[model samples]
Target chain A: ADAAAGRAKAVQCQACHGLDGISKLPDAPNLAGQNEDYLVKALHDFKTGERKNELMSTVVKPLSDADIANLAAFYHSLKP
Target chain B: ADAAAGRAKAVQCQACHGLDGISKLPDAPNLAGQNEDYLVKALHDFKTGERKNELMSTVVKPLSDADIANLAAFYHSLKP
Candidate 1:
């Protein structure tokens, strides 16, 4: 996945998970330095309803596979 | 941070997060090899209502600080 492209696409994620991948909300999990595979799986789960969170399900609905990969890459690239 | 004590205490968590810390439930995130500080913070957040999840709040309400630490330590000890 392209980290640069991922960064550009990650703007939507900035509110809860910061641009730096640290969570701004107490309820949100920080994404910085998280495992890429795990990030990808979580996003997939949210998209598929295998994981259920109202906000996350809505947010991930519009994302494609590449979008998920890019977002995971971008977040995983950051320092924890 | 006693892994052994945490293991005993983690019986309550087994229904969702497996003994190895991999999640059995779709909505539960895998805890194996997760960051210790993040795990501790998450439990604390649940306990204090900084984070809100009905089941988590109920489950963490009775946990002491040491219980949280031991749980984090035990889960973090597992391989992702």
Candidate 2:
């Protein structure tokens, strides 16, 4: 995954997740330095209703598989 | 809430959560700069099984309300 491209796609996430991949909102979780596989799976779960977070579900609804991968890569590249 | 005391009690959380309140594990969420109320409620939910995370439930089972409050206070004091 191209982390630079992922970073560009991560703009929308900055409201709750900081540009640095740390969370700005209490309800959100920080993504920086998290495992790439975990992040991808979590996003997939949110999109599929396997994980039950309304906000996360809503946010992930529009993402494609590539988008999820890129996002995971981008966030994982950051410091925890 | 004695944040200093809370910091001392947070030793157990450092395995998955860094001493700085950032998460070292993928499944764990960063607690720094999170809202106190949200953190407290999340912990309460974990303890009560309202939130269904096995690891969190196990960790929170032994926490007293005071412990939860103190931990929340300590983590909330850090940068996000």
Candidate 3:
């Protein structure tokens, strides 16, 4: 899917991060307006063994290139 | 594409997040072993307008469902 499409698909994450992409939960971090390069990498790190976060790793480990791009797009589009 | 593929694609995030999904940088976070639902939410939060992180929102605003899933998969795989 296109990143725009991915952005549209990312509705489930609203609880902690908020509808606007900010972290309402202290456990969560602000993702809005972060670097696309870093975002992509972070998502990837979670998937790969290189990163150690269990929840994030499992969540991201299954992502594809299209998925990564779309995620990057969705975050990039937000106002922060 | 599969989230596994997406997981493969997210290598760049290693800088701040570290290869282990743990955030060595104060500005960054520890994605490792985070909740899959929550991880997905954080990424989406960045992309959408509900959450408000400048860098993250811009980075994720483009993600697709595949992207979100892939990211979630990767994060979930981690040990935290």
Best by lDDT: 1
Write model 2 residue lDDT over B20-62, tens digit each, in one string: 8877876666677667867788788788876667788898999
List ranges where model 2 is wrong by over 4 Å. A20-26, A29-38, B22-38, B78-80
List, in order, the clash count of every candidate structure.
Answer: 0, 0, 116
Best by DockQ: 2
Worst 10 residues of 2 chain A by lDDT: A26-35
In candidate 3 the C-alpha lDDT for residue B8 amounts to: 70
- Native interface contacts retained, candidate 3: 0.00
lDDT of 3 by residue, A13-43 (tens): 5676665667777566556655566677667
lDDT of 1: 0.83
TM-score of 2: 0.71
- Clash pairs, model 1 backbone: none
Candidates by lDDT, descending order: 1, 2, 3
Stretches of candidate 1 above 4 Å error? B1-80
Q: Write the per-residue lDDT of candidate 1 for residues B1-80, one digit (tens) a residue.
A: 99889999999999988898877865576777666777898798789886667799999999999999999999878875
List native contact recovery per candidate, as a fraction of 1.
0.00, 0.15, 0.00
Predictions' DockQ, in order: 0.12, 0.25, 0.04
Query: lDDT of each structure?
Result: 0.83, 0.82, 0.65
**Could you tell me the TM-score of candidate 1?**
0.58
Worst 10 residues of 1 chain A by lDDT: A26-35
